[model samples]
Target: MIGQQAIRDWLFINGKIEKAVHILSSLHSPDDKVFVNRKEKDGSTSKVPCPLALKDYNSNMNFVDNFDRLKKDNQCDRKSHKWYMRLFFHFIDCCVVNSFIIYEELDTDGKKLTNKNFRREVYTGLLSRKLVDVQSPSILKKRTKSTTEISNHKPHVSKHLRLTESKHQPTQISSRRCAMCSTKKKPQRTK
Candidate 1:
């Protein structure tokens, strides 16, 4: 059985959890209120709270509950609980910065989820925000032919004649162009 410290170390080493405690602690607001303490010109400290409240630690709990639901439904890997926790923290960070949740933040693979309409709907609902764009990594095609060779599959044949069984055999002719003048020339016919 892996210890908590070992799991923590793995997560940290892999960059799966970026400052876990700091992120988790930031989400724990006393109340659903944005409190701002300011110093007045009269040298008196005044506290102003925003009526438009942020989601408290309860919201964090709900996120975890939803994650558990996903795990139960077999939609995500139950073994990677550490990854889920890190993802939750990232989601919280995105919410705090954007003042709204993002669907891709909760998605295991953003590209794969964005491709399916039904999954995208569920993702949006879970995140409580619309996604502007979810860009996937571009795939490149492999080059089969080399710039200097005619056929990539076959072995290169020499331009000169070959001696086989004490008899001179002419090499296969290649239709090539002149390097300097850019002129096409046929192979020389041997008698």
Candidate 2:
């Protein structure tokens, strides 16, 4: 208590800091302190005082730390020269890890599959599925031709009259491939 007024609830670490830090915690009120390393103005490390909550959070972020460990060590994402490929593989790895966590929670049986085993099982299941012909990647068109046919009105001398009168309609021969059919990325398809 300072005279008649008393500060409550929030911890402030402002002394000898380039930037002031304020932390409010329901668990820890102000006046809680633990010895922590701090860099002096002379650029030397020192064990200065720190809040118990901040120290605890640094030492005990178990789930996030565990995920970083798993991704770095166990994930099968490969290094690629293509920036997009690297991002894609990393995204796939994150999905696998997240799904494994969900599977662990949803499982009622006492038996639990290890992360490696879970990944392997998923890989095999994906490979075993038969892809449909229409969903296959990279279907080459037999020939490229403009499918639009103009109306049977002959062009008169006036350019404006021709544009206003003429109507071009798409002639349906075979079902044209979907927009993504010819691209060499993921899936190709045709009817």
Candidate 3:
């Protein structure tokens, strides 16, 4: 492949001047141009100016092939009938690969992480981060209750016991997100 740094050179093949070439380096960038043979609609061989990257791609594709191989080695692909979900998993795999590339660049220690290990570390880190609740307090104030409590069938409180207890203070109640409801679905409209 013709790299971005490769010097400009010309080659004559079949009497057409072919531009740059690549041998020892990776594929060339999309900046420069090269003349290559193209079949005309009239069944005549024509010289076409092709992008160096395109020419390099036509010759040998190592970058994309290597990246695909790396991603496939430890992919986050999930079996899903939904096209969007499959795309989402593939997106996740791409993100992992991107992050791994950045990590490789920033890493200075002698010890380096493999792509699989990097993905594992990333998964563990995501699982380990503290999750924050974004639900509003108004929605959280009302929570699920037992049928007996909801029916208001509590035993009558003794006047003396109530007087002895601090009625002015509010009691703290534990609340959590419901499995069957959210801010959007199953909104709590009734007390």
On lDDT, the leading prediction is 3
Clashes of 1: 0
Residue 62, model 2: Cα distance from true site in angstroms: 1.6
Each prediction's whole-model lDDT (CA): 0.37, 0.61, 0.62
Clashing pairs in 3: 2-28
Q: What is the lDDT of residue 68 in candidate 3?
A: 87
Per-residue lDDT of model 3, residues 77-183, tens digit only: 88999999999999999899988878888998867999987886787566512122233446546745535324454533335544443323333335443333434
Ranking by TM-score: 2, 3, 1
Query: Weakest 10 consecutive residues, lDDT, candidate 3?
Result: 128-137
Q: TM-score of every model?
A: 0.16, 0.42, 0.40
Off by over 4 Å in 2: 1-48, 130-191
Per-residue lDDT of 1-191 in model 1, one digit per residue for the tens?
Answer: 11122232122111112222212233223333465565788999987552111224324568777555444332322334688776775554434333223444665665533223444344445651212232232411344454653545542222331123212333444734323323225544334
Worst 10 residues of 2 by lDDT: 128-137
Deviating ranges (above 4 Å) for candidate 1:
1-55, 75-103, 106-191
Q: Ranking by lDDT, best first?
A: 3, 2, 1
- Please identify model 3 stretches exceeding 4 Å from their true place: 1-54, 58-60, 129-191
